[model samples]
Every structure is written in C-alpha cells, then in structure tokens.
Target: MNLSDYLLAQDGHDWPSLLSDWAEVLPGDFIVWIVNRLGDLVVVLPDGSVHWLDVGNGSLKRVADNREHFVSAIDEGDNANEWLAIPLVDACVASGMALGAGQCYGFKVPPMLGGAYEVSNLEPTSLAVHYGLLGQIHRQTKDLPDGTQIKFVLSP
Candidate 1:
C-alpha cells in the first residue's frame, strides 16, 4: 500500500478514541512510545517505523518513512491487498534526516476549540515531500534507542 492510501484508510475520528483507549491499556512508560498524530496516538518503533491500529476493524498497518518514498496498504475489492502510491515531502525528509534514524518529526495542527487532537507525528515521507517541495528543513535530534525507556511529553 502507499502512504496516501494508508492515510485515507485511517478513520480520522478514531484518533482521539484510540488515544483514550490506549491510555487505559498502556503502562505509563509505554506512553512514550506513542507518537501523537493530530491527536491520534500512534505507536512508533525505534527504527522510525509507525504502527497504525485500526480501531474500527481491529487491524494494524506498520509504516516506515525513509524520506525518499513510502508504501501504503491497498484495497483489492476482495479479501486481498494491493499497493498504493504516495510521495514524500522534502521538508519531512530533511527533518527526518536531521532527526536521524529511529527518530520522528512532529507537526502541530492549528488549535481547535474544545478538541483534543492537536498535533501528530508527521509521516517522515510526507514531511519529506512537504519539505522537498518547499525547500525547507526543521531542527531535530536523536537520543533514544529501540525499546528504550520513554516518557510522555507534550512536545518532542
């Protein structure tokens, strides 16, 4: 599948619900592994990979953004799967590269009154595409290890 398909497959409304549900099931430390995506808390691995849990279908998609391009889930119109195409944002690539491997970049969504969802882990590829398009780059860092102890922070 491609990145666009993966993003479209996601039920935007489920972000908050998943976050609330995960907060109950996840240990406090594990919360740090969770990456906020516009209020949706996605589990991110140390390799800069992300897991999107479909609350509606109880399914999961593991995604990795390597700056150059992305692959996404495909709907075959049956019990099958195909691949979707998505391009990366250049800025996102620059940011991801700056952040180094095993790290992700975060983007802020303008505040919505009384809404819980605000920021999201910018898809590395998407960010790359954005950055590449605009020829901009953002500051980033790398420190944590795979399965390293983590703490939930409002900002990365």
Candidate 2:
C-alpha cells in the first residue's frame, strides 16, 4: 500500500535511504518490497520490473525480464517442491522445463530423475543470467530465504 507497509512486509530494510537516489530512474508510487529474508531482497516496480537487491554487495540487478516471467519461474519452482525467493532458480527436474532448456544440460536416469546437476553450460537469456548470478551469490551465502511468497495481484 505505502512505504511503511512495504517496509513492514520486508522486515524494514531501510529502503528509503537505499533507493533514494533512484527516484528518477525507478517508479515512485507503487514500489513493493516483495521479499526480504535470509539476506536476499526482491522488489517489484510499478512497471512490472523485478529486481534483486544483492545485500552482500549492495548492488541491484534486474533478475527477471518482467513480472510474468518471474511469476512463471516461481510457479515452476513451486511445482517442483522448491521455493522462489531470490535468484529465481528451478530445481533439477526431469521435465520439458528442466534446466530452462538452453541454459543447462544433463542426463537423468530412472530414480535419479529431478536430481540436481552441474550447469554444463549457460546462455545469454535472462534465465541463464539469473541462474548464473544466483549461483555466484549463493557461493557467498548458502542460506536462502526462509520462504517464498508472491502477494501482488496478477493482471489479465
């Protein structure tokens, strides 16, 4: 609803000072701090841009191309019994959606299906970059956010 509400929802991460200079570059009225826990932060701009604020390095990077793709990644992780916090990763699963198609490659046997695999390779797609950056951030901190939740209203 407002900045206080956003702060409360995000555990009061001092956003006013964090995002003060970017007022001209970022949307003003409807900024939402969607997630903040375990050192990860996510915010949704009014224009539907999803950004991941790297707490460790204090850098903000757009992790998803748009809200739709971010939501899709969340749903994919949910369906795979995984959580969508920061870094927006999909668990290693045997399905048409595994490894995000081109960003990764691996083999899966019968019982070993859906097991995690090395990211044999990477592409230039948002998904690949997200995965790569996520891995890089993860190397710094193995503890992921406590839970995954998307409270924004989905548009038609």
Cα lDDT of model 1 by residue, 11-76, tens digit: 322333334433333233321233222212345445555454322122346543421222232232
lDDT values, one for every candidate: 0.30, 0.38
Name the lDDT of candidate 2: 0.38
TM-score, predicted candidate 2 vs. hidden true structure: 0.33
TM-score to true structure, per model: 0.23, 0.33
Q: Candidate 1, after superposition: displacement of residue 71 in Å?
A: 4.9
Global CA lDDT of candidate 1, please?
0.30
Error of 2 at 81 (Å): 12
Error of 1 at 38 (Å): 13
lDDT, residue 15, candidate 1: 37
lDDT of 2 by residue, 48-77 (tens): 778765432334567676777766765553
Please report the candidate that would top TM-score against the real structure. 2
lDDT for 152 in candidate 2 is: 34
